[model samples]
Target: MRLNQFISHHSKYSRREADRLIEEGRVNIEKNKADFNTVLEVGQRVFIDGKYLKAQNQDLYTVIVYHKPKGEIVSKKDDRDRRIVYDTLGAKYAHFISVGRLDFASEGLLLLTDSKNVARQLMQSDLEREYILKIKGSVTKEMIEAMEKGLSLQNATLGAHHKSKIKAMDFAPFLKYEVTKEGTNFSRLKVSITEGKNRELRRFFAYFKREVVDLRRVRYGWIELNALPVGKIRFLNKTEYKLLHQFLSKNDKNFYVSKKYI
Candidate 1:
């Protein structure tokens, strides 16, 4: 892997910090100063500040499910001094990386892991995400068609953050959707989709001039929120771990070869 990636994955320093260290000549590979573009080979030793940076044991890692409540951003800190997920998660999970984010107005199940590889893999995977959404105004035929056939919009910023730079978005067809309730004033639905783009669901509804009043994620892949209380966290059970192992094994054959799940 690249030098920055290696340091970030094996140590607490982020990739940006790793680059800074490289630039300052504080990193070394086999007694030679490392460069920012260095690509480490297997078994190569790396040292920082005269101390060997030991690689973490691949077999040992932890994953937890946190029931995130609305109004908290999924970040370490916010410029506006708003609450972040880590604040509610406490210092115990201060170093854990969130698998994906739930926007400030959205809530529900969120996954976090101590291993960066696990977080990255799960976030990038095409696993289905199920959500329970309450939107203003009745669900219309245009919305149904867009959800079924998918949509490509050049101006998808109606529901996005004002600072967001993404103007165009391509939405894939939803895996499934059920209109649980429909009315002139509001509507509720359960929908499943594979992609996890930024403000995807909200943008889709906004394209039809509908507002998403409440959006809550209920499930991701085989993981479910179930009866988990808001703001609480729970570790993955044996079956869930097994399923995760299988998924990792399929994605990277060398990832979990010891037949161990933690």
Candidate 2:
């Protein structure tokens, strides 16, 4: 592995912090000063600031899926005194961090992991997430086509800034969507996307002049919410973990058959 990746995988410092240490001449491999791109072989001794660092602990990792409920925040502490996900999770999971966040009004499948490297890799990977939403009213086929083709929205908050600083952005390349159920005044649909931009789904509906009455992320990557009760937590089975690791590494469409660890 690259030296900086190794450092961040094994230590508290992040990859950027490790690069800074390398630039400052504080990292060494086998008694020689190391560089950011240095390749580290297994069993090679590593030192940081003249102190020996241990090899990466492949087994000391944890990844869990938490069933977040609506009205509960994804953070550990909330100044508004609303319920937080960590408060629902037992003490055993206090050290883990949520992979991504669900806003106060939205909830569903959320991931928690003890490994920062795993979390970071998965976040940057092109893994798919599926959300099931209930909109306040029916959507026309034309709007669906426009959504599939993508839409652009401007940031009005930047109005106070200079025109050059005003931000306009496009959200496109939506993977797939289907209307599952329709009622007189409500509709339900499933939407899938590869990238989890901040409140992207909600914004997508808002652009069409509709409001989401209920939102739940029922699937993330290879995992599903299934029958897990709200506020419950469970570890990813070996198969799920392996698939996630492989997806992050290769971005393959075919599921890897090997049961080996990454």
Candidate 1, 1-262: lDDT as tens digits: 9999989888878899899999999999999999977999999999999899999886678899999999999997899999999999998888799998999999999999999988988999999999999999998999999899999999999999899999999999999999999999999999999977999999999999999999999999999999999999999998899899889889987786445554
Q: Which TM-score value belongs to model 2? A: 0.71
- lDDT string for model 2 (132-229, tens) is 99997887876688668977778622212132343465677678888999876999999888877667777677666667778899888889999899
Q: List RMSD in Å for every model shown.
A: 2.3, 6.0
Supply the global lDDT for candidate 1: 0.92
Q: Which candidate is the best by lDDT?
A: 1
Task: Work out the TM-score per prediction.
Answer: 0.90, 0.71
Among residues 3 or more apart in sequence or in different chains, the pairs in candidate 1 whose N, CA or C atoms overlap within 3 Å are none
Count clashing residue pairs in model 1: 0
Model 1 residue 170 CA deviation in Å? 1.4
lDDT for residue 155 in candidate 2, whole number 0-100: 60
